[model samples]
Target: MCGRFALFTPIPQLTNKVGAVMSERDIGPRYNVAPGTWIASIRQASEDSAPTLEEMWWGFRPSWAKGKGTQPINARVETVATNNFFKSAFAKHRCLVLADGWYEWIKNTSPKQPHYLCRQDREPLYFAAIYAKREDGRLGCAILTEPARGSSIDVHDRMPLILNDDSLESWLAPDLTDKETIRNLVGHIDADLIEHWPVSTAVNKPSEGQGDELINPL
Candidate 1:
């Protein structure tokens, strides 16, 4: 699960790459984004319009849940289409959770080492996510995760459903609502295009080590 991530890219560069207009001009760099915090996401207002960048809560809480239970930060891809909690959102409220890189733990080690993973070229990572309107009328989102593949399996058994530039349009196409079609858009991410390395474990605590140095190779 993508419990933590970083989005240090400037708002202008990020908007340019994703083809989104920024909702706010001053979205500062976030080096250690955690669940429950507001994060940037891309979504279309309608099928014919361009997508826009907006800030949304990280965890997803269904409207009927009334904020009384545990809100999940990640949804399993295997059951997302059928799960009662996520099905409706998966069908119509799909979104792109923006990030530059994500953190994963190597559990096989004595003290699980945290690793930062990102595209080889350092482009922003657009994670497949579904959002829901909360009881309080606020929007919340959850990242989609699938079984790990290739080298990523060594760090964790599951990884966020990342989308490439080619797949971005299809995944964000507002008119596409068929479950099977949506699932098919989640094509294989070339593992070779990804890079990872151990980082300081200071990221383990969400409130501390939020600087760029936290993601530096250890």
Candidate 2:
């Protein structure tokens, strides 16, 4: 699951690359982003226009969410198509969560290592995500997770559903009525797009903002 990630690209550069209009001008560097914080995401507001990149809360709590809690950070790809909390958003509110890389914890005899995972070619990785607007008008996005691919699986059971430029069209433009089409797009992340390496575990805590400590090797 994509519990942590980073986006250091300037908002204008990201807007052009993702074919999105910038919603804010000051969305600067985020090297140690965590869940439950505002993030950058791209979603088409209407059929005719390009996508919009805006700051979104990194948790999804649809109107149907019960009781008193914030929301969920990541949605399991295995059951999102049918799960009560995510199905509707999966069909209708899919988005591309923009990230330069993500940090995953690896178990070891020593201290748990934070592995930074990203595209091998040094491009931003867009994770297949779903979003929903809450009663108070907060937009939330949740990264989808599937069985690991590439070398990262040795460290974790699940990895973010990452998309390259090839699959970007299908992922960002899905037929809401066609479940099969959506499922196909969801499952076909290119394994060749990713690479991983160990780093410091300063990212274990969310309170720490973007800092060199998070990316520095121990």
Candidate 3:
């Protein structure tokens, strides 16, 4: 699962690429974007219009969930259609979470190695996500996870749903709410389009003193 990622793109560049209409809010650069934090996303409010950019809190906890707090950072693609917490959002509140890169742990014989996977051409990665509104008025989003294929399997079993320019409309269109369509859209698994390398574990302690030195080759 993609628990950590980076999103430090310039506001203008992001708006230009995705054509997202962003609010006046600016959160600045973030190297380690953890769950329970707000992240940028392009979401379509209805099935008839173009997508709009919005800031979404990166977790979901259905109000019916009997607890003080039960946050969700991801929604299993297989079960999202039927799960109460994600079903409604799956049908209509789809979104694309923007990221420059994402991190995954590769457990080899030596130790757990963390690989920072980014686009080979250094382009941005757009992840398929679903979101809904909370009673408090904040938007909640969750990343969709699917089994990895080919080279990515060597590192992790599952990867976030990635959408390129061509696949953006199908994933974001609220009208195409068919389960099989979503399954077929699992994409060709473009792991080769990604660049990966090992990094120091300093990223583990997010609050301490992690900085650019953390992404350096270990």
Top candidate, metric TM-score: 1
Candidate 2: stretches off by over 4 Å? 66-70, 108-110, 185-189
Give the per-residue lDDT of model 3 (tens digit) for 144-177.
9888754567678888878767777777777778
RMSD of each candidate relative to the true structure: 1.6, 2.2, 2.5
Model 1 TM-score on a 0 to 1 scale: 0.93
For model 2, name the residue pairs that clash: none
> Can you tell me which runs of candidate 1 are displaced by over 4 Å?
108-111
Best by lDDT: 1
TM-scores of the models, in the given order? 0.93, 0.88, 0.86
Per-residue lDDT of candidate 1, residues 22-104 (tens digit):
78456888889999899999887678789899888999998888778888999999999899999988888888988899999
What candidate 3 gets wrong by more than 4 Å, as runs, is 47-49, 64-69, 108-112, 182-189
- Compose the digit string of candidate 2's lDDT tens values, residues 1-218: 77888887666665676677878557777888887678888887556778888778888887656435768898988899899778888877888888788888886635666888877787677788888887667788889888988777867889988865666656667354366777665455568777787776667766765775566555
Q: What is the lDDT of residue 214 in candidate 3?
A: 53
All candidates in order of TM-score, best leading: 1, 2, 3
Q: Provide the lDDT at 181 for model 3.
A: 78
